[model samples]
Target: MGLNGFSFYNFPTAIELEYHQPLDKFEKEINEENILYGDKGRAYLKIFFDF
Candidate 1:
């Protein structure tokens, strides 16, 4: 099996986030610590598939 003349075209979009200075440190630590952390915050993304 092989990828024959195949290519990936992704159009992923997300909400551009703005963070407060002090909270940026916490965000970094949370990301480093655990994936389950940062339950209080929210993020956004959208994707579409085409053929």
Candidate 2:
């Protein structure tokens, strides 16, 4: 399940692995570059709406 009752139909192991390791490293690099260049950090969107 995701945020606010949103759920995934099927989650594969690869998705989990990417989140834990490679994606984390990638985010760190991006953040460091932004900081060094005096740029703002990246922002993501998460919507939570139920009908």
Candidate 3:
């Protein structure tokens, strides 16, 4: 899942927001038990300027 939005009318520079979810799964076995790890989701922001 992912989402993205942008705004350019309220600020001097254009702004962008982004969200992402890979929804991935990982497992490991050490003693017959399942272990999950690693990153599950992430987000970021961006700004654009014209000079």
Q: All candidates' lDDT scores?
A: 0.37, 0.32, 0.66
How big is the positional error of residue 50 in model 2, measured in Å on the Cα after superposition?
1.3
Estimated TM-score per prediction?
0.18, 0.19, 0.47
Determine which window of 10 residues in candidate 3 has minimal summed lDDT: 1-10
Write one digit per residue (lDDT tens) for candidate 2, span 6-49.
44455321221111112232223564573233233443345433
lDDT of 1 by residue, 21-46 (tens): 22332234464673433345444333
**Candidate 3 regions with alpha-carbon error over 4 angstroms:** 1-12, 27-39
Among the numbered candidates, top lDDT falls to 3
Error of 1 at 51 (Å): 8.2
lDDT of 2 at 32: 53
Model 3: per-residue Cα lDDT over 1-51, one tens digit each: 334455557565655667777667778897999887655766878777651
Which candidate should be chosen as best, given TM-score against the real structure?
3
Model 2 residue runs over 4 Å out of place are: 1-40
- TM-score (C-alpha, index-matched) for candidate 2: 0.19
